[model samples]
Target: MATSIFFFVLLFTTVLSRTTPDEASRTKTLDITSSIQKILNPFSVKTFNSFKQEENTVSSSSLLSFQLHSRVAVRGTSHKDYNSLTLARLQRDSTRVKSLQTKVDLVVQGIGKSDLKPMESEFQAEKIEGPIISGTSQGSGEYFSRIGVGHPPSQVYMVLDTGSDVNWIQCAPCADCYQQADPIFEPAASSSYSPLNCNTQQCKSLDVSECRNNTCLYEVSYGDGSYTVGDFVTESITFGGSSSVEKVAIGCGHNNEGLFVGAAGLLGLGGGKLSFPSQINATSFSYCLVDRDSDSTSTLEFNGKTSPDAVTAPLVRNSKLDTFYYLDLTGISVAGNAISVSPLAFKVSDNGDGGVIVDSGTAVTRLQTDVYNTLRDEFVKGTRHLTSTNGVALFDTCYNLKSMKSVEVPTVSFRFSNGKELPLPAKNYLIPVDSSGTFCFAFAPTSSSLSIIGNVQQQGTRVSFDLANSLIGFSPNKC
Candidate 1:
């Protein structure tokens, strides 16, 4: 009797040691079965099908706001089925991540070189157009905003990209152009349109340019062999009837080809000197990405009001690549238990080799291989009671939750250098990958040294970029 009682006590102690009160409090009940259905057809429903022209752009005091929508939601591309569309989106996501990696590699290589003329000398060696550091495009940009392009303000959908610096649009008399939802912008009809001479300061600011018939010509090439070449011009870009920024330097692409379909062009929101935010002298910007399964629209605001409830982290600058919003991620926790990971995994080198970037374009979050392994292991251990299954695509950690109506999940949070933690929503991390109720961890491993905090993990969170103050803030459940 004594021996049996001792064994029972020992078993209880082992179980108690596995879960402390602090850790137990971090767990939340998740409706896994129901949540799985929402993500299976992520692109099936859109927040809004048609744009309300009058309400497209709204300015309140100093803030210039625009209605943001997912690319697929804006009626650009037609997919045969939801599964196929979801698969295609995932494929594009992978390609975009690879292309972003290449851009980072090139930026690092160009460091210490002539910042003003870095690409001029190397352009001849590589047959690609523009500087490699100008950034790549692959029709992978996720969010888009509608804005007026001409005097009467022809409404057009422009992809919102923080990774790119040059704003461009598909113009008329095109040698080649990808199919888009809106009719190509007719430069001849817009009285506010004017070509920039090769000698203009704006033309000279381009990473790579050529003088043709005294008009400045610009070209941007992508890692996937996509290219857009056209005349560089300045036009009056209208936000609303009362608000308009004139002579905004923009690319009028006559020859363009790529995976870019649905949207008219891209609005560059990078930290570079040529990006739209910089050109307008905007002090800050903020965006709240709505959940893919949600039918609600979100706002993308410039010079916007600050979020009082947001937890901010200092934005670390990578001198080699100032376009990306790099941050120091000190650690991560699963159910209040810190995952064992080397700080060096998230360190940004002087030359910008390895670091973490919060990108609006990428769909899935990627971490350094070692760090991701530890995170995956920790999460799996916490969720052992649930049945494990084979992962889908980029996700190696997955589970079959078809039989369960609801399950308690370990809450995940990211600890930044400022001691502020960004807690993730349950649906954001454990995403549905298929219709069979197979859910997988949304985060993936990147072989490259750079790690990306993608949109999947940022859902329902208001991410603010205060460029003037050099800070990025995360306010949860704002979308």
Candidate 2:
């Protein structure tokens, strides 16, 4: 009990900074579907009018905000025909998407009141490495160079995604019809770039149509509604630094539609493509991120598995499954109390995509109906007697946020795929809403997925996505 209580206080620390209006909005919008719109409105000029047009755009906030409110939230995977403009990964995909959102909301609500400082500090390296890479395409505006350069080199801004398997970019002479990002990946001029023919081992792995010329074909959708379709290519990509990787199989998007601004391509970081490292003459994928350009040198860790000090936090390493980091959940806790959640079987559905996805791109954690309700109940029972928000129509959860107890926040711990349990800041998990009079923790009126572990929950935590080992690892740090 004492240990639990200690964690309770530790988790509640972020709330100390929540006195700002930003937090007030997050407290309300956490469970609501338009969280990113509400959270980033102050910073961005874009209206974020609809779900489909929202995902592909770069946010004034981090990429995290852009990923949270996707078209998927509005529709399910069944609507795949809708395109990013309509068929996006439905704010709820595979019961798992819902769980992820719920998890993020709960943690935000719980940790909004924590005592920790905002973890926006930075450290960078000259060259980026690993699966992280900058997106590139024909029309994608100006590419922000970490070390500069790539300008007019047919620079393509690529989408860095964890939810996909194919690493693809926009290409020229595509009959499929696509808006360019920054000039297409020119096959003729790119001395190092080459397409994979249908007969190769790589093309056969897609498991769908026959690999005609060693080219594996694929298409991917996002929650906010953006999609790309094209053939795979075996090419060489260079990072800003000295490292370069060759023969990396990537998708050359031949067809794309809807809200594809600057037409940047995608950086596939899921288990499958990211797991295989580049051979002798090439370096694998990597990135150098910094909130402020004036910040210190941001470091780069190859494969982030052995080296724990990759980011601000020590990464917890877990192996990859195909192309995803499957973080296992040993148990789910509410109100600082642990719950008996079955492995893979979400209380809401027999099919568990139940484990948490340590996505650095997602803004919140999506949770299952049962898990969300249990945690909400704990918040209602423990906090200022209620949680509420001003905008009731767009989002849910009840008012009484003022009276909500500031102390004893519930700590939500996740057991990683490697048998390690990691506890996140409680406020980073819950959301508040207001009704006619009573205030209660209410689930998003539209939520239907099991869970998604977003970037917010990953703050200060280093996540190691090891495709080779088939696991992901994370470690907490003082953000």
Candidate 3:
């Protein structure tokens, strides 16, 4: 007990000790004591059909909370455990998809579909309550290829991603040979290795990043006004273990910008993009997500950190975002009470590149105009605590800083395109702040290039970015 407490204290303190103003203050004031107490509470936590009465006010700010995230991968140490080979394949497949997509795009144009592009899937993900989970990799075809099973011959770090859809990194191609933070893909030796060239179908017909010399190269822009350009390559890809060999797209080039953080490139999963090279099954690419703050570490199988009582709903699929799933968020609640707010209506769009992405990059849950007002008004009701600085409203609706009360999971039920409704965990509603911050919304505030759904609200759901179906599916389950 003492040891566990010590570790918790240590981690808690470390989280609070963040140096940056934006991060430091929030962690320090997260009210961890109360949150921990709530976690330890013996009573059964319940789910709410709606939110607190206060969530109704529309956020005065033009900006909605957006979600931006990256995965933390532990690189395999030995050459046998390296993720280098898989890197090659990821790059190769990307090129193939682009060529195929170019042809498809032309077909759509021929059919008079003005903005005709591949279809997509949309879904909602609920936030969980455990430490980040790390599931086992099932090999070439499984979701956890970053953490291969059996014994991997080569290993690499998880592909660092921006919201962009392309994932690639410099491999042996760089003689400087520094151990950049992101893993490198060695295409020279891979059996399935291939590099793009200028004559490729995509390069010849589309305006996308050109595929020259067997390399697909392009620049990606970020909400923060950042971008990266690189070449695409194909190499041997693996998952679970050696037996799970698959093809994947990989980027390789000089990524000097800090945004990529030594990352060669990103694994694209957006609807706007034309490919899913990262997926092993020539059909779909699955990008399994383990919550940043989850507790389970089963590799590919992270039994999320959701409340046990949160009810399960039908898994619905949608064509709105190609292959992504959509959530039926009918209501939100606080402290076990439903807020009197109307549900939101949604219209999906291709964010930026061609990938299935949930917008966790924004600061507040910026719903469509009408939905935004409804949810905001309901979230701020019965405010026992309130504060404002620099003209932002901060509410005390969060759990006790030391009590860990089971804030009734704010149910964000979604009515899928397939007509199924799913009620996700409640923790997705009670966001954590380092300090007494304002009620952070989950949508992007600025009418930026792409609409985003921030991570602050993805607290207890299983979000799957499947490229095979060109869908981003959200499973409303307890974390």
Candidate 4:
């Protein structure tokens, strides 16, 4: 499986680098037009044009709320080959999970060695670059949001990530760049794009920085081998359609390499100082992801109010892994039956490892090996009467739905330490593998100490991150 995974990675790398300029330009234009249509359909021509033309006059207070749909929904508009799409998505998701596991392992190792030496030195030796704004890799099946950057804002689509802290976009004068579905942003054209000098406070905030001819140079590498090296700059950023914030910190990536197909870069929503939420002074942000199959668009809003009926959980904060949103998962239940897993299994260790995190960049839920075994065994017992089938590479529990007229799937719930419980629907756990009646468990076991609640389990739910109060809220079917 590892060999096959690497093969796909090599193939994707070749394809990305071999794309002709004409092909890339054509795809870029088509994707931009498609994205515009998706976002503009709900408004009148007069209203849409007015918002774009009068963007500068829009006040910060008036621009407080904006919404964006998932990239998956946006891509569905242009996907002509549906038969191959599902398989491709699954393959990419598998690769993403593997990459996340590698990251968890690296974090654990770095923390364990912190007492012996500086963590920064250990990370550098491993080629694990610090946080810089880069796009979410394609296999994650994540969502993208449109944001306008620079003066006289140039609109660019970027992956919306809560696990990252730096906002970045592909910039012109690139040493090496990947082919994106949108036009690369030219910093020279924007009157407001000013590079930060190395001595400035903003440049000093970066985890990894270098002084290059007085300009601040930054580089960030992901666990999946995707990297972005660029200059740090401040510019205006517009969210949704009307809300614009001035003098925002962002990475103008001149050199980038990754599997970011449709996105020009990433919009980081993490809690760090460099994150979009922190920079914009947003009290809270919320998103409601629609079902994967639904053609209906979902919403990602900044400075959005929490629902009155939403359940709240205390967010765990680890200074060592500040870029991720951590949550304390006390227990899990299947069909009202409690699984006996130790609370310590979900706790972060003293070395700053082993904890449950809510990540928007991962496609499927990942659990520690022992916890997953217990859950999988219990699940198998509950559905023992059904005819089982051979497992997929990562998914061990697959059932042939053709043998039964109806499937009875148990409800799975996650109990948090804050007394809040999230009861997930069957679709969140049992995902369709193909056009045939084959369904597989969406949860996978990881060798690493960390666990993740991925976007699949977040479907049809409104997840709100209140950074000011350090609380996480969830309201089902609120989209």
TM-score winner between 2 and 3, please give it: 2
Which numbered prediction scores highest in TM-score against the true structure?
A: 1
- Per-residue CA lDDT of model 1 for 171-283, tens digit only, reads 99977778776789999999999999989988887877888789888876666666677889988777644478888999998877665646788888888877899899988
Each candidate: what lDDT? 0.78, 0.40, 0.34, 0.70
Clashes of 1: 0
Total backbone clashes of model 2? 139
Better of 1 and 3 by TM-score: 1
How do these models rank on lDDT, best leading?
Answer: 1, 4, 2, 3
**lDDT of model 1, residue 128:** 46
TM-scores for all candidates: the values are 0.87, 0.56, 0.52, 0.79
Give the local distance difference test score of model 3: 0.34
TM-score of 4: 0.79
Total clashing pairs in model 3:
184
Tens-place lDDT digits, model 3, residues 105-132:
4443444233333211110011111221
TM-score for candidate 1: 0.87
Q: Where is model 3 more than 4 Å wrong at Cα? A: 1-153, 160-163, 172-179, 182-192, 202-207, 210-218, 221-226, 245-247, 262-264, 272-274, 277-291, 294-345, 348-364, 382-421, 435-451, 464-479
Alpha-carbon error at 296 in model 2, in Å?
A: 12
Taking the candidates one at a time, how many backbone clashes does each contain?
Answer: 0, 139, 184, 1
Candidate 2 — which residues are off by over 4 angstroms?
1-153, 176-181, 207-227, 261-263, 273-301, 305-321, 340-356, 360-362, 385-408, 415-420, 430-450, 466-471, 477-479
Of candidate 3, the 10-residue stretch with the lowest lDDT total is: 135-144
